[model samples]
Target chain A: MRTNLMMTAAAGAILATGMTTAAMADGHATDLTLCWAAWDPANSLIELSKDFEEQSGHTMNFEFVPWTSFADRMLNELNSGGQLCDLMIGDSQWIGGGAENGHYVKLNDFFDANGITMDDFLPATVTGYAEWPKNTPNYYALPAYADVVGWTYRKDWFERPELQVEFMDTYGRALDVPANLAELKDIAEFFQGRDIDGTTVYGAAIYTERGSEGITMGVTNVLYNYGFEYENPDQPYDIDGFVNSAGAVEGLQFYKDLYDVGTPPGSSNWYMGENIDAYRSGQVAMQMNFAFIWPGVEADENVGGGNSGYFPNPAGPAGQFAQLGGQGISVVAYSEKQDAALEYIQWFAQPEVQQRWWDLGGASALRAVVEDPDFATSQPYAQTFLDSMAIVKDFWAEPAYADLLIPMQERMHNFVIAGDGTAQEALDGLVRDWIEVFEDEGKI
Target chain B: MTYSPIDRAAAKTPDGVARRIRGLSDRTIAWIFVAPTIFLLLAVNIFPLIWTIRLSFTNFRVNRPNNAVEWVGLRNYERILTDPDVWNTMQATAHFLIWTITLQVLIGFTLAYLINKKFRGNDLWTTIIVFPMMLSPAVVGNFWTFLYQPQIGLFNYVVAFFTGVDPASFSMIGDVHLAPWAIVIADTWMWTPFVMLICLAGLRSIPDSIYEAAECDRASKWRQFWTITIPMALPFLMLAVLFRGIENFKMFDLVVQLTGGGPGNTTTLTSIDLKREAFEKWRTGYSSAYAVILFVTVFGLASIYVKALNKVKER
Candidate 1:
C-alpha cells in the first residue's frame, strides 16, 4: 500500500511540472500592447512584430495615433494609469519628462546586463532622441528608427534644358540643385510662376503648423542654419545675444521671402500630411521632410516611383543642419512583462532582423544594417537617407523642453503668419519665455 | 380675562401646530433641496476653478508634475500683461471676433427674414443653410482648407477668374496679411447658420398683426422692416452675438486646422496661445493664469451682456 501511494504521488507531481512548463512555453505575457504615431512605417513595425510573436509564442497588440494628438494621448495615458500599452514608441522629447515621472523604465541596467553597447547605434541617433542629455549613459529607450530632415525635389523639372537655360541666364549661374540659402531662394523665385505639364507648381513647402510641432520642426532647420542658439554657450540658460542674432534674422527674412515669392497662396497651414499631398500631386517643386516618407514617395504613383530625388538641406552661413525627428522603442515601467519585453528588444536588434526591417522599407537605427551595401542596393533611396544622416541635428530634449518649445512655436507662427513682429522680437520673446519657465522650475 | 382662558387654551393648540411647521423655514428647506446640486457644483465647477486659481500662483508644469512648485505671486499675470505676443494674439482674437460677428449678424438676419416669409421650399432652404453648423469644426476646417488651396482649390479658381493673380502664387492662409481673414471667413461660413436659426425663431414669433398695422398706416417695406422687424429681432440678435462672442473668444480647433495660427502668428488667437502655453509648453501655472484672465474678461462681458439682454426684454 505504501509503494502504491508513493507511485501515485510521483505521477501527480510529474503532471503538475508538465503543466507549468507548458504555460511557460506559451509566454510570460498573455498579450502585449505597442503604441506609436499613425503612419505607413508604424504599419511596417506592426507587421515586423508578427514575426516576433511567431518566434516567441506571444500575441502583439498595437495602438497607432495621428501625429497631431500623439503627445496629448500619451500624456493622458501616463497620467491616468492606463495599462493599455506595454511597449511604446515615444518621441525623444518625452524621455526627460517620462523618466522624471517614472513613466518609462531606466534601461541602463538592462543594457548593461544584456551586453548592449551604445556604440552599436549611430551617435546622433542615440544621443539626439534617446539620451536625456548629450552623451549620458542613462538610457530610457532603445533607438528604433532614426528620421532626419531632407529635401525632396523633382529631378524631371531640374533636368529641363529650357528651364535650366532660363534659370542660368536669369541668375547668372547654372541651377544644379541649390547649395546654399541664396541659391535656394533664387531657385524658388525662378520656379514660382513656371507652368509644368499645364499645372502650376510652387517652389517649396516647409511646415508652419501652429497647434503641433510642425512649425518648430520646420523653422529649427533654418534657425540653426542661421546661427540661432537657444542659450549662451557657457551660461546655457542665458539667451541675450544668441536668441535673436543677425544670422537668425536673416534666416527668418529668407523664409518670409520664400513664402512671399514661391509658396502657393493659402499654404500657411501646411503640415507634413498636407506638404506630402502637395508634393505628391505635383503642385510643389520641393519639400523639406523626413526619411519616413521615402517608401511612400518611392511607391506612390504620383510623386514617387522614379519621380522624387532626395538631398540634404542646403548649407547656411553657419554650415548645413537638419532637424533629427524620430521615435524610440521604450518599455513601460509599469509593465508586468519586463523579461518578455527585453526579449522582444533583443530579438528586434538581431542583425538578421535589422536587415529584414531595412528590406521592408523601414529605416534602421543599427549602424551596420543602415550602412550595409546589400541593404542600400535593394532600396533606391537608402543611400540618400544614409548621406543625409551625417548632417542631422536635434532640438532640445530637456524635461522643460516642451515648455520652452511652446513659446517658440507660438512666436514662430506669430512671426511667419501674423507678421506681428520681426524674428528678433519673436526670438527675444522666446528667450524671455524660456527664462520665465526655467526660473519657475528653479532650473537656472 | 377669566372667561377668555378656555378660548385662549383652545386657540393655543392649533396655533402651536402651525408655529411648529412654520419654524422649518422656507430658506432652510430650500437649502436642503439644493444641497446635492451645490455639492455637484463644488465638485465639478468650483473645485477646478479654485485649483486653477491656486495653480496660477505657482510655477507648475504638466510634464514635470512632481517638480517643486514655487510661489511666483502675480508674476504670471504681470508677464502676460507685459508680453507683446499675448497682446498681439488678443488683437487677432478681437479682429476675428469683430469681423465674424458683424458678417454673421447681417447675413444671418437677412436669411432669417427671407426664410420667415414662408417662401417656397423654405423648410428645405433652412435645413440646407443650417447644415454647415451641423458638421464638426475639424471637418469644416479641413474642407475649407482644401477649398482655400491655391493650386486646385475652387476658391482660388474663382478668384483667378476675376483678379488674374496666378492662383498658385497666393495662399489665403499662408499670406501673413490674409491668414486672419481666412480664419474669419471659415468661421463665418460655419456659424452664420446658427445665428440665422435663432433669428428665424424670433422672426416667426412676431405676430402678423404688427405687419398688418404697419400696412394700414401705409408704412413702406423698408419702414416696416426698420420699425417692427428690427425692434422685435433685437433680443435674438443680442443672444446670437452673446453666443458667438463667447465661442469665438475661445476658438481653437478651426484655426488649429485652417492655419494653426500661422503663416507666422497672424491667426494665433488668445485660446491658441493659451493652449501653446498650457499643454504644449506644459507651463500649467502660466496657462492657468491665462485661463483666469480670459475667464474674468469673458465673465465681466457676459454679465454686462446679460443685464443688457434683461433691459431689452423689459422694452
Candidate 2:
C-alpha cells in the first residue's frame, strides 16, 4: 500500500510539471520585442529574427538604442518593470541584477523542456552570459553573441618593405604580430607620428573614454594578464591585495605609458566609434576595439580587404587575457507574452538557425558554429575572435555592478588619461570604493 | 424695447440657475476658475519637491523594491558635504559659472553698445549675431566638438594661424587645462547673444534727451557714459545675470555632448556628477539629498540677488 501511494504521488508530481510546461506552450501568435544596442550586429539580428518570426508566427519588434545610452535606457526599463521589451540582449554584467532582482524569467525549466543544453554553447559564454551565481547550473539567459576585445592593425602599413625595414632597424626585430603587451607597445611607439603615404599618422587608438565603460574595458585587457584578480579566489569580495597587486600596478602604468607615448593627439576621449573612425580615416596604425567591428573593418573601403589584420590581445607577464564583450538574451519577467517569447527562444536555439545567425553577421556563441574547422577561415578576424574569446574575462557582475563600475571608470580615467595619481593609488582607491559598495549590500 | 444679448440670455435662465448665479461671490467664482491651475501646481511642482525631501532622509533605491528601506537620516547629506570629489565638482561648476558670466557680460555689453549706434545694415548685423544663440545647445555642442578637433578643425587652424603652434599638438577638448575653457567658449558663443539683446534693450531705453542735456552741460563722452549708461543698464544687466546664473547651474546637455565631463574630472560640473549619482548609479536617495542641497543653494543665492536688484532699482 505504501509503494502504491509513493508511485501515485510521483505520477501526480509529473502531471503537475507537465501542466506548468504546457501552460507556457500555449499555441498563440503574439508580438515580441527584442531590445539591444544599435550597431551592426543589431541590424544583423533584425535580419536573422525574420526567419524566427516566419517560423514561429510571432511578430518580431526591435527596440535598439545607441551604445552610449543603451545601458542607461534598458536598465531603466527593466528596473521599472516596464513591459516594452519582451526580450532583452542585456550586457553580461547585468546578469546578476537581472536574475537577483527577478527582472529576467529563469530559463532552466524552459531549456530542459525544449532540450536546449548549455553544453552545446561555448563554455565561456555559458559561464559569462547564462549562470547568475556563476559556475552554478541556474540559468537566466541564453548566450546570444560572442565578443572579446582585440586588436586590428593596418596590415598594409606593417607589410610595406621600407617601413618594415625601419621598424626592424629601430626595434632590432622583424615587426610582426605582437606576442606580448610589451611588444605591442613597442610597435605602437614605432608607428607613433610616422608619415604614411605623405600623410601624418599616429599609433594605436586605445579606449580612454571617461563617460562610460570604455577605459575600464580597455584597461582590464592589460590588468587581467598582469594578475589583477577581482577578488580572492578562496573568499569572495575580499579584494585588498588581489585588485591592487604589484603586477596590476605595472599593467596600469604600462597602459598609461602607451596612452602618453603612442595614441594620436586628441584621442583622449576616444571609444569604439572614435577608434573605428581613426583607423578608417588612416589617422592611426591600429585600434583596440571589440571583435564585433571586425566585419565592418574588413568591408571598409579605406582599410578593408587584407589591408587590416586582427589579433587577440597580446599576452602580459602573468597570463594572456582579453576583456569579454557580449550579451545574452533573456525573457523579461514582466512580459505578458511569455508563451510567444519562449517560442522565439526555442526557435532561436536551433543549430541551423544559429549557423544562419553567424552567416548574417551576428556572432553566434554556439560551439558547433565557432568550433567548426571552417570557422577559423570564415572571416579575416574569425580566428582572432575565437582565440580572444578563449582568454576572456568580464567585469564584476554583482547586482551593484553599476556602483562598482562607476568608481572604476573614474579611477581608471583619472590615472590613465588625466595623469592624476599613481596606478597603485588608483587601484587602492578602487578597492575602498568596491568594499564600501559590498558593505552596503551586506556582502561584507 | 430691444434687449442686449447678455440681458436676453439672463432673462431666459431658469429661476434655480439665476438664484445660484446671484448667490455666487466674485472671490468664489474666481477660485472655481483657478482651481485646475492650483491643482496642477501642487501635483507637478510642490509634490515632487516634497517627495524628494522625504526621499533624501531615507535609503531608498527605486530599482530595488524588495530591499528594506532604512532611514539613513543625514548620512547622505554628510557624505556630499565631506566628499572631496563633490567639492571638486562644485569647483568646476563655480569656474564655469564665473567665466561664462564674465565673458558673456563683457562681450555682450560691447556688442550691444556697438549695435545701439545706428549703422548701415545694423538690423542685419544684429540678426546675424543672434544666429548662434538661436541654434540648439546640443547642436552647438556637437559642431563645436568638430571645430575643436585637433589638426582637422577650423578653430585649431585659426588659432594655429595666429599663434603659429602646431594644430596637431594641442587638443581643445582633450587637454585637461583646455577642456574647462572649451566648454566655457561654447557656452559663451551660444548665450552671449542673449545677454547682448538684454543689454541692447537697456541701451535703447536710455533717453536721447538725457545725452543731449549732458552735451549742453559740456560733459565729456566718457563721463556721460559711466554716470548715465552704467547705472541705467545695471538693473537689466543684473537681471540677465540672474537668468544666466540659474540656467548655467543646471547646464547638462551641451557639456555632456561635448566632453562628457571628462579628460579626467576636469570638466565634471555638479549637474553631471549629480546625474551620474541619481540615474546611472541609481542612488536615488543620495541624489535626492544632492538635489535638495543644490535647490537650497540656488534658492538662497537668487533670493539675495533679487533683493540687491530691488535695492538697485530703488536707487
Candidate 3:
C-alpha cells in the first residue's frame, strides 16, 4: 500500500509537468507544420522562422522533402489524414488541382481580415501560382518563391575578341547575347566542339528526364515561345491548333537541331543535376534553368563567382516568353491549426521579414520587397531575376494540368532522345492524349 | 453418505485426468501452436491483399482522396490489356528474362562443374565465384553504369580500341534498342553466382559412386557426363530457373537506377510502369489494378514452374 501511494505521487508529478509544458505552448492557438522542398534555401527559411516563433509564440514544425518527391509526398500526407503538415510549399502546377480538391485552405477571408492585399505581390507571381484562375479572387495560396525560366552563359568565352571576330565572320553579325531563337541556335553551333582555354566545351545543356518534371520544365520554354497553348481560349482541351501548330513544331525541331549539333554526346539522358554539373564543370557554354539555380551558380567556385552571366530566354517568332516555375505556401485544409498557420503566413509576408529573406539568398514574392533597392542590391543577379519575373507565363492553370503534362513530357523526351518521330508527329500525339485526359476528367 | 464421499474422490482423480487428456485434440493443439503465425499472416498478408483487391476496382487518386470513389469494374484491366505500350513493355521484360536466365544457367553450371573437380585452390575458387551475388544489387548497378559510360568507361575504352568507333558517340542508356540489354547483362553478371552456388550444392550431393560405376562400365568421360551428371543436376537447374524467372519478372530497382525506364519507355517493364502510375502520377486505383495483374501473372507462372520442378525432382 505504501509503494502504491508513492507510485501515484510520482505519476501526479509527471502529469503536472506535462500539463505545465502544454500550458506554456498552448496560449497561441496551436502548432503549425510547414512543408517545402529540401535544399539549402529551405534551411535558410527554417533559420528565418525563429523570429516568427518568438513573436507569435506558436511552435512550428517543418517537413522538407526533395524536389522529386515533393508533390507526391504532400498529396499522400494530406490524403492519409496524417497531420504531416499544416502549411506546404507546393509546385505551381499543383495549385489548381490542390484548390479544386480542397487540399488548400481558402485564403480570401484571411487576407481580408488581415488587411493583406494580393496586389502587394508581384502580379505575375500572384496570378500564376497563387490564384486558382488567372486574376481570380479565390486565392488558395500565397506565392512564396517566384522563379522563372532563364539562361546562363559563359561570359568569358563570349568576350574573347578573336572568337567574336570569327563568330561575326562566320554568321555575318557581331556575337552578342541572342535576341531570338535563331540567334541562340547560331551561337550554339558556333561554339560547338570548340577548344576554349585548352579545354573542350559544348554549346548547351538541357534536361531530358523521362520521369517527373524535368522534360516539362525544359521543353516549356520552347513550347510557349512558339505559341503552344494547352487549350483553346474558348474551350478547354480544344488544342488542335496550338499543340501541333507549325510554329511549335519549328520550335521542337529547333531544339532537336540544337541537340544534334551543339550538345555533348549523351546529353539526351541529362537532368537538372547533370545540367548543374555540366555548367559548374564549364563543359557547356550555356544552360537554361530557373532562378533557383542562380545562387548555386553564383556561389560555386567553378561556375558562379566570376564566370557566370544571366539572360532571359530568347524570344521566338511569336513572342518573348519564359515558363513560370515557382512554389507557393498553402495551408492544408485538414490541419487542426488553421489559425496558427494563417498567423505564420501573415508573419512571413511582412516586408521587413521578406527583406531579411532576400539577404539570405531567398527569392522574394512581395512586389514591395522585391522592388526595394536594398533587396535588389543584396545579390548580383537579384535585379536581373526581378526584371525577368515580369515576362513569365505559366502553362495550364486547370485542375487536370498534371494529367495533361505527363503525355507531353513523354513525347518530348521521345522526340529529343530517340528521334523516332517528327516534331509534328510527337506534338500531334500529345494533343490527342491531352484531349483524352481532359475529356475523361470532364474538364472539356 | 460418508462412504459415498470417499468413493467419489477416488473416481474424480482418474476422471479429471482423462477429461484433460481428451480435451486436447490433435488439430486443436496444433492450431494453438500456430495461432501466433496465423494471426500474423492475417494481419500482414491477408488484410493488405483484400484492401488492394477492393481498391483495384475503384477509381481512386491519391491527390484527390476526398472525392467520391467510382467503381470502374474492369476498366483498368481492359485498358492494360489493349494498350500497345504496355504490351511493348511486357515484351521487353520477357526478352530480359529469357536472356538473363539462359546466360546465368549456362555460365553458372559451367563454373560449378569446373569448381567441383578437386583442383588447386578449389575452395578459394568457389568463394571468389560466389562473391558477386553477395554484393547489393544497387552497388552492382551503380558500378556497372560507370563501367558502361561511353567516353571513359572501361568497356567502351576496350571496345573503342578494337572497333575504332568514337566512344563518346554511343550511349548505353540513351539508346532504346540497347537499354534493355544493358539491364539484362548487369542482372546476369550479379546473379549468376547464386545459380552457381545452387548447382554446386547439387553437384556435391551426387555421390562419387555413380562416376565410379560409370568408370567400371568403361564409359567415356562424355558418356558419363551426359548419362549421369546431367540427369542428376537437372532438378537443381530447373529450380534455379524457377527462382530466377520469378525474380526477373518483377525486376525494378536495378533497372530504375540504370535506365530509369527511359529512352521512350523502351526499357520500362510492367513494374516500372506501375510505379510511375501509382507513385509518380498518384493514380492509386489504376496502379493497384496494374499490380494485381502482375501478381496474378507471376503467381500463375511460378505455380506451374514449381510443379515441373517437383516432377524433375521425382524423376
**Alpha-carbon TM-score of each model against the true structure:** 0.88, 0.95, 0.90
For model 1 chain A, the run of ten residues with the poorest summed lDDT: A11-20
| lDDT pick, better of 2 and 3 | 2
Q: Per model, how much of the real contact set is kept?
A: 0.84, 0.67, 0.57
Error of 1 at B1 (Å): 46
What tens-digit string does per-residue lDDT give for candidate 2 at A41-149?
9999989887666555567899999888899999999999999999999999999999999999999999999778999999999999999999999999999999999
Q: Score the docking of each candidate (DockQ).
A: 0.51, 0.73, 0.45
Kindly list the per-residue Cα lDDT of model 1 for residues B1-315, writing each as its tens digit: 464885676577687676775678889879989999999999999999999999999877766656788899999999899988789899999999999999999999998988888678988998999999999999989998889877678888889999998876677887777778889899999999999999998998889999999999999999988999999989999999999999999999998888777766678799988987876676789999999999999999999999999899899
TM-score winner, 2 or 3: 2
Q: Write the per-residue lDDT of candidate 1 for residues A112-200, one digit (tens) a residue.
A: 88667778888888887567756778888888888988888887788889988998789998877788877887887778767899977
Q: How good is chain A of candidate 3, measured by TM-score? A: 0.90
Residues A1-444, model 3: lDDT tens digits? 335435644554454344335535776435678998887678878888876665566676889988766766776776566677889888888788778888888899999987678898898988887888667788888888888888888887888999999998999998888989889888888888789888778888876777667877877788778877766788756889978888889888887887788776666667667788788888889988788888989998777776788888888888878888888898888888887788778777766666667777678898767766566666767776876797788877677666777777778888877787899999999888887777767766
C-alpha local distance difference test of each model: 0.81, 0.91, 0.81
Tell me the tens digit of each residue's lDDT in model 2 across B1-315: 999998999999999989988988989979989999999999999999999999999989877878998999999999999999999999999999999999999999999999999889999999999999889889999999999999688999999999999998999998888999999999999999999999999999999999999999999999998999999999999999999999999999899989989878989999999999998889999999999999999999999999999999999
lDDT of the structure predicted as candidate 2: 0.91
